[model samples]
Target: MPPDPADDREAGTVFLPKFDDRGLLTAIAVDAKNSEILMVAFMNEDALAATRASGAAHFWSRSRQSLWKKGETSGNILRVREILVDCDQDALILRCDPAGPACHTGARSCFYRRLEGEALVRVKT
Candidate 1:
């Protein structure tokens, strides 16, 4: 039998992830040591399972319509140290040690720009 939601959802030990309508959940990768936000992505069941099994970060590419392991081509893998699920189990934080740049543009973080007055300014690294 399944665990009761009232008892096992927020305060229980059981892990029950609440996926969205697209069978995906929001996942944020952060530097485990410095707490720097690296990137944000989505993960499906297969991506989550792969991440758990491989100790590497994997994500479902919405545009590509496929599951991809980070650093498959760039060798900038996000080595996951810990996975933290939100209280609602709808979002996840992947505490990771990144091998290289997290952004596709070779920025240390995907959020390498800041919104200014009608412009996107590059953040000083």
Candidate 2:
């Protein structure tokens, strides 16, 4: 059964995520201490549950069609401190303390560049 529209969900204590037609929700990871965005990924039901259970950031790999824990291979795990859901329950923000660079390219954040005019420019760290 679904949650009550008026008494639950956005205004209530129950956590009812609204996954998209693809059965995935957007998850954004941010630095817990500095509030810098680390990465953005997708999460399925299993990934969400794993993250909550392990206190680590887990995501659904859209390309690989599998579940993966952040930093599983690179030792750059994201230790999640808190998960904040959007009012509509379709998106989540994970505040985390990252063990190392969040990007596969070894950048501190996946978002290391900005659009300048028609080109991408690396943001000065």
Candidate 3:
């Protein structure tokens, strides 16, 4: 069943909720001027807890099945400016202040590749 809007909004405002497997978080990394989705990260229970406790961005690595802080090892830190949970409490919207490139390859974002016709070409690389 879908959760009540008020209830979920309250929950997100008061109690930071966890995301399920099917959940998808839209990480909108605006130029800090114009809002845009630079990259996205999925959060499990641990990731949510860690991010809530700390201002840092944490995500559950789907492949590794482990918790990973955005800039745990790298100096490129991703700070959470604001967080929004969907009405159904299924997905998330994170507005962040990226200190450095969000992409592991040191690009401005993870979505540097554009859809060229039908091929998935590396536009930035």
Q: By TM-score, who's the top model here?
A: 1
Model 2 Cα lDDT, one tens digit per residue, 1-125: 87568556678878999899999999999999999999999999999999999999999999999999999999999999999999989999999999999999999999999999999999965
What TM-score does structure 2 among the candidates reach? Answer: 0.94
Using lDDT, give the best candidate's number: 1
**How much is 102 displaced in model 1, in angstroms?**
0.4
Lowest summed lDDT window (length 10), candidate 1? 2-11
Clashes of each: 0, 0, 0
Give the Å error, residue 13, model 2. Answer: 1.1
Error of 1 at 15 (Å): 0.7
lDDT of 3 by residue, 12-58 (tens): 55553534545534344444444556677788777777887898888
lDDT of model 2 at position 76: 98
How many angstroms is residue 91 displaced in model 2 relative to the true structure, after the best TM-score fit?
Answer: 0.4
Tell me each candidate's TM-score: 0.95, 0.94, 0.74
How close to the true structure is residue 81 of candidate 2, measured as C-alpha lDDT?
A: 96
Which residue pairs in candidate 3 collide?
A: none
After superposition, candidate 1 runs with Cα above 4 Å error: 1-6
Task: Give per-residue lDDT, candidate 2, residue 26.
Answer: 100
Candidate 1, pairs of clashing residues: none
| Candidate 1 per-residue C-alpha lDDT over 18-75 given as tens digits, one digit per residue, 9 for 90 to 100 | 8999999999999999999999999999999999999999999999999999999999
Model 3 TM-score on a 0 to 1 scale: 0.74
